[model samples]
Target: MDLKNLFNVNGKVVLVTGGSRGIGEMIATGFVSGGAKVYITSRSADACDKVAKELNARGPGQCVPIPADLQSVDEIKRLVAEISKQDSHLDVLVNNAGANWNGSFHDYPDEAFDKVISLNLKRIFTLSQACLPLLSAKASNANPSSVINIGSIDGIRVPPQDTYAYSASKAGLHHLTRHMAGKLGGDGILVNAIAPGAFQSKMMKATLDAFGDIIKSKIPVRRIGSPEDIAGTCIYLASRAGQYTNGAVITVDGGAAVSANL
Candidate 1:
């Protein structure tokens, strides 16, 4: 009945991987802006500290930065342990760290493929597993913890660019969201994915630069995704409004993928 507080996330503790840039940064900002205590991580210590400092300065909330390369299990454990040192429980976790490679079908390097899969897919599971304690510690039947996976529309439809590893990894991530939801629901940990469309990200800069107008023309919304668009979607997922929304792949692509099917 209290609709005003339906999406309230004040005082919540959130962790966002690759939170120094792109969608991760956006999600972190959304939480911090809503008075949540947010922790952001990245491979670059400088990047992590910089974003955290800036958000902290602009806050009714607080931001912490934990910089650790997420390529190996050891590093993932270190990151989670560090979080445990600071907080007893986590209200939200956004697995947004990712990488991509563009190459011809014949000339794609094996290392590039492995690199994309390692960060985008393998590391997510590792980090999420490591955070199980923090995630489930304060989770409950009425108010559950949330895990938001940042996937892509490329996984649902063939992208115009040559990012085989990125697309395939996202598709796998979408399914993994469902798998984890089934496994974690009883513990009151909700798992879901947000498959984003084109946004102003370093990864999308070249594509948007080359095809920004054309890309917008094809979509039903006729525009690329804004930071607010992604930020709002994530906030909803972490808020009370989305407690029942598990195992769902919500596309925040301005209807690009759906129109593609039509």
Candidate 2:
């Protein structure tokens, strides 16, 4: 068994939600570089198109953009339909789209909580279900289809910040990954979650900008996450190297989950 071939994902059909920016983009970039035909979706059509163009320019593979607001079942189905029209099966699905709302416990609004949960947790479950056929169609015991959920360190550990809904939704997603993995394993669909630490994303940009040094000091690695940190993890899980890994929540947080209480 060649180790290099074990990590290869060349020509695999992949879809990555929220791939226009942040961690989603990071994962998509890795897939594209690894020669996978990647479809990236986000709410912003222009951003998606822009990213797709950029990725395509740098690829042995191709990137296509499909913009959709995945907060509703209708939109999720629509996205699935779009993909089915172009491809008969999907090799990997990255549920990376999510939202966060921050507020004090006493002040957090119910509407805010609902909005975050809908996008972060509900959408992931619904979208994965929607793509079941495509995922299953390409799955086999030797090369199982992959579902990689983008969880957060906040889900595994209580953070100092007041992001109640964000944390709750991610925690929920992490468990959902396990549940789905168990249910889908028989069909050769391996499900896993990546719990990431602070990274340079649009989501974390404001906080990092405000107190970069302070945040770095708190983390055991003394720095935030990088694109390579996330991209490499996704590649591992999506490739033959991680075929036997199921129901695992791989924390790529630079030890933040363990050091948070320190």
C-alpha TM-score for every candidate: 0.98, 0.98
lDDT of candidate 2 at residue 75, scale 0 to 100 = 88
Regions more than 4 Å wrong, model 2: none
lDDT of 1 by residue, 64-110 (tens): 99999999788899999999999999999999999999999999999
What local lDDT does model 1 show for residue 104? 98
Choose the strongest candidate by TM-score.
2
Error of 2 at 136 (Å): 0.5
Question: Residue pairs in steric clash, candidate 2?
Answer: none
Model 2 lDDT at residue 34: 93
Q: Give the TM-score of candidate 1.
A: 0.98
Give Cα-based local distance difference scores for all models: 0.93, 0.94
Candidate 2 TM-score, C-alpha based: 0.98
**For model 2, what is the alpha-carbon lDDT of residue 97?**
95
lDDT of 1 at 123: 88
* Candidate with best lDDT: 2
